[model samples]
Target: MITDNTGGLPRYCHPYHGGWDVATIALNIPESRILFICPVTCARNICLNAINGGYKDRVDVLALTEDDIVSGSYEEKTVAAACEILDTVQPRPKAMILYVSCIDAMLGNDHSFQTEEIMSCYPDVTCFVLKMCPITRFSGDLPLVALQHDMYAPLPEEPVPHTDTVGFIGSNIALHPDNELIRILQDAGYRPLHIQACDRYEDYLAIRSAKVNLCLMPFGKTAGELLAERYGAKMIPYFARPDFTSIRTTITAVCNALDIALPDLDAMEAETVRILQECAAYIGDTELVIDSTATLFPDILRKTLTACGFRIRRIYADGVQQKAPDIDAGSIQMPLVRSYEDNENVIAIGMAASSFAGADKTVNMFYDNGEWGHYALRMLAARIRAAYEHPRSAVQVRKEARK
Candidate 1:
């Protein structure tokens, strides 16, 4: 019996990132009504979130269950259910999205055939299918998904545009609400042509037209490379970390690539310094110990947190690919089992359980909320502040206060 914790990776890891092999088909036709069919365990969360984010009217979601997996007739039933839902809804969807799960993959269910059958029955509705192959064994690797996006999205209609717009690529999972990159670009007087990760097919096809591309996360390297090859676009890679200097470096590189005059480094440096100073106040003298199934934000967090005066005692990161050389070596390496003493100062960062033998706090940093990467840093800073302001209750006494 294999027993691996399903909660290893942060839930906010974007669906578009290749951590799960999701297949997408774009119909030239605009989709008015849509349906999402997925495994029972994963469906409610994904569908509800999408609905909360304003896709409810056009979207209908249903989950497949264990019985369906056992019977192998679930696919047919799922299609029938979707059609029924469409009929009940009155206006049928122009496009349908069939989201298959790991069970479907294991059963070797032919989604294409299911789609064809559905099409023959309801010829008016355009149909599409996507597969979600969870990277439980491999964890989530965003670059792999970015490649898949490149492969699945239709080719551009015209030659790549030669505009000054830059392509911003990364898993939407990693983006903060403030959208730091967009702020920086706007501050620097440049307009971004494309900011991918959750963009529609048309936007993806327009990526080749950008004058250059800025890869904010490693997961975008594959897509960036593809666009460069096809459209002569140059790529500027940046990792997530809150260092003002790093941000400045990124901006400089981008400016150079676009032939835009460099922003005053002194001014940029001062602004970054101010942000770090404020961050330091929030993160003073606290110690953190993070463990993740993947090295999503460790490097950036380490650099930024260290600058802000926090002590990183240890990190247990897993599922690291050899390709991510930028990851810090001093941090705990990947594929590690629990081996720490769990001192009072330690606070964990990834999907690892909070109940490890000796840790003071097992904070869950990533989850399906699609805001893990952004929230983790802020949460870390807030925890540190709480600890300093109330040392006696800081260790474990003030759970409600922390919240």
Candidate 2:
């Protein structure tokens, strides 16, 4: 059953996609701490998420009350809070991310004042103003994209000479060193860089020396452009897709940008297809479900898996209608206010689908897990095969996944 868009307000958002939230992503910086200022109501969930992610020690909340917001004293309050944290916190964070939530967006608070005050008080600690404002989502950069951009906005561009470094942006989890992208750069005598691989603030700051920036996700394009404008690095924007054709196109685009010889696409595609066929054969007509959380482009994943003879039972995503005009499987908008029935035989691919289906067999993949090109497709096939061979509780799988 193909569902039509009944656009209005957002109904539900399932919690099974145990990938890192915005706060966790911001904490990716080495020795960095966050001071998230928002209404007390929002702090409950944010604090709990921080505690669960094992970064509670690095997170400080300044819960705003109605009086504090109405009086416009939140700014001063934030300054005091930041000063106290800076003065007492052991070893002192190298960078402080001053995060304000949606209410701050409505208040039209000037963050520069807070940032300036903090820096004045603690000259050694670098201050960055980050917003979690969803109200401005449609106007400028969405919160997540803005966060990605701000994460590296403070790196010094001047006096950092260009090197053989090729920066990979937008993936919280670094691509495996054995990935084809890394192999291509290595073969061309270049070093691949990802923020997740950085062990120190200085290592993360080394992105300023990259000659080229490959943005693996769309949100990273803004950050990539920043690097290009400031550091004169070439920004190549590509998305992670599981299909063979898209993978080839991404590789070709990257090679063209770098003026490097094209890789042997035929051999890579053949190997990936062989893996997919073997996995599909083993699964043997078992119903599979995909969710948007696994791949932003569920339509593409559906086509890729279906071509490999895997039976796609349904796709639960909100925005697949526009891309998938001729939908072949059940298409249900996520976060519906009803309960999902449990199924024993269904093998769910993507955390959202696993949670929604309550299926025993689940593939623990979220946003392709930073995989791109043929490597992504091959790994997906292998994970699916593994899930079939060794079934596990969907809930347990979600818990075990790294945020």
Candidate 3:
């Protein structure tokens, strides 16, 4: 399906950045494999993506046939294919996730009917059925939340709160390994938990023992609710945009949540200031065109960049709900890239930005580089420095490094 307006771009081009969403979370699990049940056409994209990502060995496709559609016998063929997968692979996967594409989601075919039989066939492997339909993006249990809920299901239903342990539930990308937030948590006499560090499934379940849970991403809201409902951990949502005040707010919120005094506020602000200075030095007076499709907080990002000497020509996102007063005052288009007047001079962010404006300097707000909080400033600065020469942006740096 052609999602949204493609801005007169090539029909075959991806609508946005190639994010697997919750499917990418499966990669974090040990000995896990994805059983992608999609059409032959979609399967081709999946196959090529896996190969390009160097994980083709882990992906298997169950392409649907015309006969299967006409006969409506997908349930049987799916079961048979899954059973065949169990018998064929060596050192079998510990978990096999059955992922249905958009077609199946609309068909209203429940694959759970065979869940019991599949488990019975292979008692050793854990199984789950996840919907991979992006069409349900705005609706309840969109792919990201649904997959996260299921992946986290392996953890205990009832978690025990531990005063010393604090957990963060959301995008792993935002939690940098060297995040200073972890240091603050430690100073407040608490250990930090961000799902990335959990190697074992038991470690993930162990989060129930945290005294407080911080929900970072919109998808993480469900995870936070699960932890709170089952484990009774306090779930605090962190949100603010369009200004630098959010950094101070987050720092204060973290302190309050942990029942500790605010950390040296002057010191944290100094760090934020230093990062902003670095960005200003590298990215001067260029008209920047930013898209919200990539970053979680484009409005906040917009205000921050503006304060640091960058001239934003356009913010391609609706800032009304996000409270980006600055963006609302500026040129906030649905993004008419092909009709854009200044593709050459503007610096763009996100794949959507890259698509429309065709900016030579692009900071693709890809998965990993979409940092949150004060640390986000540092990530953006460093990316700008690297991209200053070629204008490839932060995400493009990661992509090139892969080669």
Q: Please tell me which predicted candidate would have the highest lDDT against the true structure.
A: 2
Q: Write candidate 3's Cα lDDT for 1-403 as tens digits.
A: 6554434444333344454444456655556777887787766666665777787787788888888877888778778888898889888877788878888867878777666778888988777787778777655676777766666665646546466788877664437655667778877778787656565555555687988887766767787887788888888776424345766787788888777888777787777777777677667776776666656666667677777777777666654444655443222343323543334656676655655565667665654353566676777667666555666533443354321
Report the poorest 10 consecutive residues by lDDT, candidate 3. Answer: 328-337
Against the hidden true structure, what lDDT does model 2 obtain?
0.81
Looking at model 3, residue 213 earns an lDDT score of: 80
Better-scoring candidate (TM-score), 1 or 2:
2
Q: Estimate each model's TM-score.
A: 0.61, 0.91, 0.82
Clashing pairs in 3: 160-209, 162-209, 242-300, 337-356, 361-391
Error of 2 at 194 (Å): 1.0
Q: Residue 120: error of model 1 in Å?
A: 8.6
Candidate 2 structure quality by residue, lDDT tens digits, 123-183: 8888988878767777688778998998989886584898988898987778988899889
Mark the regions of model 3 whose C-alpha exceeds 4 Å error after superposition.
1-20, 154-163, 172-174, 186-191, 239-243, 318-343, 391-403
**Which candidate's TM-score is highest?**
2
376, model 2: CA deviation in Å?
1.8
lDDT of 1 by residue, 235-268 (tens): 7876554455666677677767766666566764
Global CA lDDT computed for model 3: 0.67
